[model samples]
Target: MRQYWINFKGNQEGPMSLEQLAQKGLDETAYVWHSGLADWVKITTVPELNDMLNNSAKAAQESPAELPEQEPEAVTEEVPELETEEVPELPQEEAIADEVPSLDNVIESPAPNYGGQQQYAMPVAPQQGPAPQEAPKCPPTNLVWSIIATVLCCSIPGIVGIVFAFLTKKYYREGNLEKAQRMSDYGAWSVIISIMLGIISMPLSCAMNIFKVAM
Candidate 1:
């Protein structure tokens, strides 16, 4: 007969007989005998011993002496700053003058008549006294002129040509060849004027460049 301390339920109450120990949840498979220790060791047959060991370990971990609170370290970072640039302003008079060339130089041209001699030409009938004139049958020529004018009117000239082209196209489509021709002519003139203005501005631009260098 041998005696050993064993825990059961929630209390330690073991001084029981070996047979009683066996009846109280102790089994031969639950314990290993250490003959060198000279004692009959109580064995545990409970399947939850691993869980109990884990819980004991967790309790040991949670003990204040086992784990101390650590102070968090502060982190710092370097940031880059963006550089801003200032924009230069242009003279108001120069801006206004740049727009004036396109507006002021519109010139109208006369319409030509082939007198029914050309291919795809419309025949012109002689008018009797106060005869009503028939509408012209050609596609609107103002579209072509408008396109040309728009190209030439770049900067300021383009604005004037576009306006003239629109107005002239209306009259031209209504069988007014004179008005259409006038619009087309004005668009051509605007192109020429714009080119001349651009040429004249080149010298001023060159002078400004030289002045800038000298300054």
Candidate 2:
């Protein structure tokens, strides 16, 4: 029997009988040569190595090197919480003010009432009780005019105008309409008198100054 030899790991690993080579288990793609063979051939081609090749292939299939499939990395998601906003309550007084009717709402009457008779043609005014007396309108104290009169005209009437102006506002606030009106008239008269005096005195004052300068 010719002894078989095989190369492994880049060197001659065996020079044994075929039976011994088979027992040792040849690689599936191992190269083998013998005294009769022309060149090295696959160990599997040899009938003797077939059992070893089958056993190796079965072992490899049973214990594969690939890692077990990983369950798709557990996907974890964080859901954010939403915040709630609160509305503030309005005060009773302000709420009541909003509910109150507007002043301009009471007095407006757009269309006149129509009647067939000429005598009834005049629109009857809405019935209402005698209206409360309106507060009196105060006249200006003529303070500006009073100051002008005092500076450029006679001082006596200007001072009186300013005094009457002050009295006009005071009497009106006190509900003394007659007195307030009287004060208003007097104030105007005082300012007029002061202006007339100032005009008349202006020429006299200039003339007197000129006469003194000549002297």
Candidate 3:
């Protein structure tokens, strides 16, 4: 007796006679190998195995009718099958009908108007970004006034004012509005402070000279 080997699901599980192989009830999809085979092929691909499957199928069909009575077989032969058209199963049709309700019972959403004078789409509001912070108004630079104060009033304070006047422009360009404004205020206030001091120091001396000349 010839022996065959079978592989199933990545496990090799046979080196048996055909009877032993048939006992395992393997499907034709199982791979079988025997001597002279190049590689294992599906049992269905082999002609011998194909006939074996067909024979088994015929055996299965005959098993139910294998009762020891010739009379039932004679009766079956004598009886003629009626030619009847098969109507569709009612339950399946009813199931489909239930799934999809009639249009009469369906609630519909309002349809869009496609007729004359199509209305324009509503304008969308522009996306607003963060509002820009307004730059603080820079005070007077006081550059010319600082120079005059340096000559007539106080040298140090007037020079300091001139320095800040120059800084104001630089700070403003660099987006430091706060620093620019402070520099501008410092420059203007320096000139005012110098004027006040000059008046306080010379006011009395000038008045005395004027009174003496008037006499």
Candidate 4:
């Protein structure tokens, strides 16, 4: 006799014979396994279980009908009664009136004088600072002389004088009074140098011309 195993309700049920398996009233689709089989198969596919399955079906059909279902007994539950309670009544109170204070009940007193005892603070004038010193005036820039020298005398020194003259005016406008004064002196010197060169060059040029005519 060959024993079989089946998975029933998530558990490996048994190494039971086909006769015992048929007694379990298993469905045709139930999975069964034995050592002879490579994998679990449905009972309906097994030739050995065919006769047992047919017998089980015939026996289920010929079985006597189940007794008519008995009607469930009607349940009767008893509920307990609740007791009632009585509350006592309280006495009523009388209303009270508001009271006002009389002047005769209060004592009178006089306010003290503060006439000469308090000293008044006098307002003090803010101290004035010495008047701001006036800014010194800009020295002569000699711009007119520098321009005249640049036009009529030596160009190099005359152009230098004109540049210094412009610098003097620019520095004075920019609030640099000391630098402006120095630039003014420089412009004056350049103008004087140009005038001196013009004077000396004129005499030398006249002497050369006289010599050339004599030769």
Residue pairs with clashing backbones, model 2: 141-165, 153-198
Ranking by lDDT: 3, 4, 2, 1
Per-candidate TM-score against the hidden true structure: 0.31, 0.37, 0.33, 0.38
List per-prediction Cα lDDT, in the order shown: 0.37, 0.50, 0.53, 0.52
**TM-score of candidate 2 versus the correct structure, residues matched by position:** 0.37
Residue lDDT tens for model 1, 70-136: 1011001001101111110122123323532321211111122322233122112111111112223
Off by over 4 Å in 1: 1-154
Candidate 2: misplaced stretches above 4 Å?
Answer: 1-135
Q: Ten consecutive residues with minimal summed lDDT in candidate 2?
A: 73-82
Model 3: runs farther than 4 Å from truth?
1-138, 205-215
Candidate numbers, best TM-score first, in rank order: 4, 2, 3, 1
- The candidate 3 region of ten consecutive residues with least summed lDDT is 122-131
In the range 1-215, model 3's lDDT, one tens digit per residue, is: 33566654334554576657656666644556543332334565444454455555555667656533432443342223112111212232343245434211111322232212221120110011110111134456889999999999978888988998999877764545568789999998999888888888697779999999999
Global local distance difference test of model 1? 0.37
Alpha carbon deviation, residue 15, candidate 1 (Å)? 99
Q: What is the lDDT of residue 84 in candidate 2?
A: 11
